[model samples]
Target: MANTHEMTVPVTRPTAARQPHPSGRRLTAHLASVADDLTALWQRLEDDPAVAFHQGRAWVEAWREATGANLCLVTLEQDGAAVAMLPLEIKRSCGLSIARFAGTAFSNENTGLLDSVRLADLAPVTADELALTLSQAGLGADVVLFDKLTPATAADAPYSALPKVFHQNPSFQLPLFADFSAVLAQINGKRRRKKMRVSERRLEAMGGYRHLIGEDDALALRLLETFFRQKALRFAAQGLPDVFADPAVRTFLRILATDRDANGRAALELHGLELAGGDHEGEIIAVSGLTLKHGHVTCQFGSINDVIAADVSAGELLFYRMIERAALAGHKLFDFGVGDQSYKRSWCPQRTELVDCYVPLNLKGRLAAPLIAGMIRLKRVIKTSPGLHRLATWLRGLPVRRQKAAAEPD
Candidate 1:
């Protein structure tokens, strides 16, 4: 038998009063709000190690501050002990409600932050129970979006069985390696070393490369600014909003740079490397800000120069050094986060899948259900077809000429 943590929760109908839909057939939940109870549930699950950073408390706070979202927690408890939790934020736009797990849109991975042990047997029961409970609590969102949920989460999730639920998009995650040699082997040691040699020779021909790990407040700010500029350039070239366009992004980065654990130590360790030589001139070539916590390090944010003077391999080198430093720092896992880019796969052997699902409650749900269903189907069509995805990527690259032109002045 699995532990209590692994038990599936049984679902029950909403006991609260509900108003009849216009169709006079369907019903909506009418239970009094239970935000307090739900918050406690969120805290309990967040305190666990199984949850990823996106679903963690810090991210929730950061997202609320950055997006000004209305956050609410929901949970199911038996005998006063919480069994499951969902931290959802509702956004109203265009007269429609968008419901999603707190901090999900920007961050990768949006699983319910469930206790695997407690849910082992309850996988079948979890979703239904959650739906009923949420309806009772007046979760009035017309659409609920869950992004980048690990595959296992879907398999174990309670409501994934709904036939209308469909998957259209997918992302990838890379594993962090503790062994330097292992990483080298994966990326083609001989070829990579040769490239490194060439870069070194070219760099030497100029002058020499300089590496600087930021120290103190001012220097950290400068390095972070450089990273933002470079990252924005990359996004503009690709025709996407540099998420860091908002000052909040910078504020968050700086907080990580200067923050520390409860014991009062450096919370952020940001690296800034400068490369200069004959015509090369001194310029920021690579910058990476890694968050360290509980023996784990995440490549939180980073950017590299695309200029000719810089080496394509510098970013890899910086990552290599980060791995070494992480080991030295006694960290165990390094997460590359979500995305299925080829570079990520070069270093990661492990892959996790994300999932989304839906259920309807009233006449409005019945009416909107088809649109949601169509979107899900269309998404699948686009994702499974390589040609379509390529076309999308290409189209995404076109409108960014303005951003690219703006960056050119840099």
Candidate 2:
């Protein structure tokens, strides 16, 4: 297959002089080839506190590690002062290239980190000039995946008209309450009270519900392993092969953790809820690994140990706590990241759509894009279809018992 990636050039307006004008004050895209510039810019920017990768000295270092194909950075400068910055990474595999955000698939959402205050004050001339400058920059990518964008920033983005640029639905955001009482009120007053009642009774009858946010260095790695094991087995049992079962996928996460850790000097957060009591002591029921990006917190990867704690509501409690911590930390958003789940809806009334928009750059690739999209849509339909899904599960040698066994350590 040829390198079949789509490229989007910001739509431009023809100048009165009959020239196409770039939308923003000629924004400049520069390769963060200089460590000093990147480090300085990252530190000065009001980045999301939850994400360590985009802050301080480490962000520059991460760029060095993942320097494969050059997608470079778009630096919007106003009179020599850096105003807006977008870090982009381009990856090539299987003879195809795609431009996603730097560390995106793993990142909950990445922002262009433009100065809304400055942008808001700009005249049409300034906006066009900036856009033209960025447009002229020698940035090349087959496809641009502008991951999860905050509503505020996305609203002001100059490149919104770029092909395939669309806002995903409002992502799920959980309101962090000041106290447990506030949290329970949001979950359906009566239902929340009942659940809490049940939880208290269970705890009194047993020992207590244990919540752990592993602070150990090895906790993140271990939790990630468990999550993958559970997720893979679950998918396999459902008659679907785990897409992330590939080593490269695993390697990417490991590398991501290591790289981000080295940069931020902080380990990933791994939250676990366990059933602790009686003969079955310390059985893990739910686990989640979340990534912090500046002031934005996102639930990255996680799994629930539903077997032993089916009655305990460990997962719900854990998530509830996560929101509390996020709110306490003053995080603006707590992204459930991607996916639609019943629990997510309970906590968040808002949701954003994640779309894979395509603009075929080449004739052959263009023709194939629609077909590929249809195929993807079809796969989703089949996977979600109840009866066929069960059949597929059976064919995949799926059994709950076997799944549990496979998940256990030797």
Candidate 3:
């Protein structure tokens, strides 16, 4: 049965309350059908450095609204205060109900639930108490799969401490120094400056350009539409799938850009480089979306106007502007998010380790776990091996390559 508001269960003891929890304190898992239940808890931890923006209440709610995914929140409360929680979107697949972290496919990293208090180190539990509780609590999930987890995840609890394999693609981030020059030194300062100078001269000749931040809601929405068009064209050129082709995704991104909290902190922020007064005056050259929380900022996605993108390097210039602003604002890290692009590698020096964890709650899950694990392993090998990765890319691009060859004058 699908999770419903009627299935909402209050905070209570775990159904499998046999032994004491390893933390010497109870961390009981409870089922909540509505994500609104987290509003109160989110208020307490919204600013907590431990709580990532991907797990932020607004971000989660936006995803749910946009995708219409069934929400099944598993909250662990201790002494009445919520210590940790997992907001999952239950999906039925292969005769089994699988509970996955909401927005997992789009998220850069998953920090499997962590105690908000950051309590002292606790011994690892042999059994997955959270999973056990979830199984019996009956949200109708046969398996709980958590993936794209960063190595920085807390691992004392059963849910997070289980055996796992490295995730497909590791995330990347760069330290943001207050002095912009100091930041440059960490990533080929000389070469970066030379490129920046060249881009500046080119842009200057083209009636100059201005970096525009989407502070205005209307302008931000417009920029977002432009980004979609740019990305669709780019993806078509590369023969890659257009992830943004889904209307739901577009709606989700729009919500992220518009929905804001009392503090004006929206789930997504947009920035672009626009032509000032050239023949294509006011036309956007590059667009980027970002998510910021506490002192960390992550690039969600970016697109460029490829037709006129030869020597201007609009994308790089936009990043330089944003990175400088982030650094000046004292943000600690500028994450490049998921993927292994040449630009990401050159910009971000720190590679964050990622992992996946799967817990089977029933016979069906147990039977299917191995198959799922094997597939994940294969994907990891392909992503991590340079030769395999190159071959895979070449294969994926074959259609476009073949088309171009056929169109050439013989």
Candidate 4:
């Protein structure tokens, strides 16, 4: 049996409740009391076409295993039918309870689930009501943070509508076409698109190259291992924290890579570029991790071989092939996910803006919210400025440098 914690917030008529909504049905908010109930609610929400893979049950389960956070799944129901749901994971930070959307650390999109039927009827609780319930739920959280939420999610999703500090985190996306050539034609720079083909030819001339899409678990695992190693080297060189260094996160990704949904489609798809001959024969030159669902393919993470064949732009070549694959699979969108990269802009013409919403549940939270918002803003400024970003990178590498020195022979 799965351990569960639940709380129910009653709602009378609109006149009685603190927040007012359109008169149609009285909705009551409650946390899932058991694993069975949570699973059932999750299934119902997953049925909605708006629910993304990150907000799905499989991803949530993987997050639970990876982080072991206290699950707090809230549901708003009308006449016993679930209308909305917000999945959260609670943890203590700096002696204060903090609740954030489940899988926020790794998930590119964090959209709360909402029943399409209820949404059509405009019967689901508003953002205000949801926030009020969470604040009074007695979950002992000092603050609730919802990150990377978009306005289109869940009928005016609370993250963007709530009275809180909003921080920008934009994502890039490309609309897929029926053919690869059509997609390439839409890219802004003609020279850039031509250059991509030149890069592919360059890679081909060096013996040969192949785009490998791993469907089998064994092959996927091998590719994933390579991805981790390459990612570690890249991060170390850039002086950035290696998030994949954690064993738990690695295990979670491995499980995700191998997992298939009821439709037999993998939760995570592994794609790589392999050199067929020469000094780098059989070497995985570049690898990209992706998630496909509801006609959308999201790039989770990707890395390339900077040491060998750097001039060929293996990563860019890999993306061209992957985008073609997604287009052939009838996907509607190819999302670069959250980031500001020069390559992303080359492929994705549309920029989807995202925001982080923070709500204080108590006195302590009130004090922490501004500090958190300021920090996020500062980081954004640093990331956008090349000089500051380089300085920040150097500062981050100091710890690793010290560790290396300590291990060196005297």
Sorted by lDDT (best first), the order is 3, 4, 1, 2
Compose the digit string of candidate 4's lDDT tens values, residues 191-291.
65677789878877888888888788888988899999999999878756788999989988988998886766678899999899887799998999999
lDDT string, candidate 3, 1-410, tens digits: 11111111121122233455655466556788786666776566566776667777777788999999998888766545566678888998877788888888788876634564543433333345655667766757877887776654524354444556666777778889889888888888888888888998998888989888887689889889999999999988877667898999999999999987677766688999998877888899999999988888999999999987557989999999899999999998999988867787788767766667777778887788778878888987999799998888778878767787899899
Q: Count backbone overlaps in model 4.
A: 0
Better of 1 and 3 by lDDT: 3
Per-residue error (Å), model 3, residue 154: 4.8
Tens digits of per-residue lDDT for model 1, 1-410 = 10111112232232234332233222122222344444655666866765766676566655666666687665544334445566678877666676778756556556665766655533243334445556676787765555555555655644444333434544432334456555456446576567667766766776877776776667777888899899988886677766788876667556666655466444556787677665656687889876544555666677898875554567766776666666555566666665545555555544444455665545565467567767767866776678988887777666665656777865
The estimated TM-scores of all candidates read: 0.75, 0.70, 0.87, 0.87
lDDT string for model 2 (1-410, tens) is 01112222332322333233355444354555454556666656645342234322343345435544253666766545666666666666445454556655555445555566665654333333433454456445433445555433334444433323333223465545445455545556567557656765765466666677656547656666767877786675565667668675665555545543544534357777655786566766678876666556768767776466567676666776677777776665566865545667776645554333333333443445445456545655656577875676576654545776788999
- Higher-ranked by TM-score: 1 or 2: 1
What lDDT score belongs to each candidate, Candidate 1 first?
0.60, 0.55, 0.77, 0.75
lDDT of 3: 0.77
lDDT of 2: 0.55
| Better model by TM-score: candidate 1 vs candidate 3 | 3
lDDT of model 1 at residue 215? 68
Pick by TM-score: 2 or 3, better one: 3
- Counting clashing residue pairs in each candidate, in order, gives 21, 31, 0, 0
